[model samples]
Target chain A: MAAFIIANGAAAMGDDVTMFFTFWGLNALRKPENIKVKKSFLQGMFGKMMPRGADKLGISKMNFGGMGAAMMKTVMKQQNVTTLPELIQTAKEQDIKMIACTMSMDVMGIREEELIDGLEFAGVATYLGEADEANVNLFI
Target chain B: MAAFIIANGAAAMGDDVTMFFTFWGLNALRKPENIKVKKSFLQGMFGKMMPRGADKLGISKMNFGGMGAAMMKTVMKQQNVTTLPELIQTAKEQDIKMIACTMSMDVMGIREEELIDGLEFAGVATYLGEADEANVNLFI
Candidate 1:
């Protein structure tokens, strides 16, 4: 199976990270200025989940005042861990691969024209080829 | 890179659910009866300062505190998720492959004999095969 951590936490941990920009995942890869926001509890209770772009669902590191994202950054910083922005730059510099799903882009009305530069267009087969070979895979 | 969610969380969320176990992940794979008591406060504090496994340094889910473990189980039930024990059994039934790092086990004083049955012993090469092949990999 393909392990997907749709979230961007890995970048902050300073690991080589790649995100298959499918569905919500595209939010982060989209124009950086375009911040994705998640739906509210009322949505889930009414089956009206927001399912917004993924960057919206990031885990708050410290979760202070629901500032988990900021808290995470602080804890990691106190420990000398890297930040998400830094991770993105590092992965690109190190040649860590990033794949954006063509099908997803179409389904969500996204266009390659909308994505940030330096992304590759791929499909299920590409994801599977990478996932099947991994000894450890995760869907976060 | 590996994704490590404490198998002990089985009590908080049932184990039958699919959880990608890596790093201290193999800790839960140890036998339930042999599980050690929860790591100490000092250990937790140190872990807070160290990398993920600092708390799990000497413990696995199986031999960890029975009372504490049971409490985790109760919380998961209240939360409506699966239990850890059930997760392990489910992993077997689902054929979710789990690999225990030989190096960490060695450093932590664990032996193949101490782990829960059915674990695959592997090293960097094994992980490399998976990492190179997988589209998404993580270290949590």
Candidate 2:
């Protein structure tokens, strides 16, 4: 949620924004109904235990069995702020670059078709190359 | 560790940086030997179970009984990268603004003395004020 907010804000300000999603971060890009994955026993457990997508994700701290997430959503709504999904859509509309890490996808058994469309795929080198020239690079 | 790495890297590159420590994030600023807190039972449990300071912090993912943190430290050493504590100290030396959220400290019953020196205290308003003027604002 924070990533999408920042990305949208930066993109709105005309900054060239790139969100490199890797590991669990890729969960945000997963289609809500198509989040199934095949992996080792423990890895599969991890996948099953995790929230399906951005809408279901709990906040990192003070998340009282998902209550905190719900409260946050309510607060955002009350404040007339865009929802996480809306922020993501806004980011897409603003043409912010979204890169999915190929290595992580392979290890996690996530296929391209399972993710939302209009995203590029690359490895660490690609991210480093972009970070090298960028003035502001963040990992949220 | 990720936060410190990014902070130190940005500061080294002559970027003005501000890290707002809130809730669990304040744990990283706690002085390892003096981390005692007087909160509600559950909050105290949360405080006690968490790592004491930057050195004791575990990674967000793949933290297998602290092994992942140890391995990460080892890798940093092998790569001639600064440890988390060292990176934090570097951030301090580079004059990166470190703000401990007053609201979080109050809720957690964390005394200001328990945190490292040479830091400031503020609320969200101050952070927003800084972020409003800055070209690069990130939450980690």
Best by TM-score: 2
TM-scores, each model vs. reference: 0.43, 0.56
Residues A1-140, model 1: lDDT tens digits = 01222223344334455556577666556654433334354422322232233344454122335454544444445545445555555556655578989997666656676566788999989888876754444554
Which of the numbered candidates is closest to the native, going by highest lDDT? 2
Q: Write the per-residue lDDT of candidate 2 for residues A1-140, one digit (tens) a residue.
A: 65776567667766788999999898888788845555678666666676667797777865768766675566456446677688778989999999999999888767787788899999999999998877667677
Candidate 1 chain B weakest lDDT stretch, 10 residues: B50-59
What is the DockQ (computed on Cα atoms) for candidate 2? 0.12
Error (Å) of candidate 2 at residue A31 is: 0.5
lDDT of residue A4 for candidate 1: 29
Give the clashing pairs for model 2: none
> What's the DockQ for every one of the candidates?
0.13, 0.12
How big is the positional error of residue B40 in model 1, measured in Å on the Cα after superposition? 17
- Per-residue lDDT tens digits for candidate 2, residues B1-140, read 77788878888898888998876788889888955555555445455656678888788888898899889889989999888788888888899999998756655557788888988999656665576667676667
Question: In candidate 1, what are the lDDT values of residues B18-137, reduced to their tens digit?
Answer: 233443455556654443444444333322432232123332245354565556656768997765556566556555567777644443335566567776887544565555455445
lDDT of each: 0.51, 0.77
| Docking quality tier of model 1 | incorrect
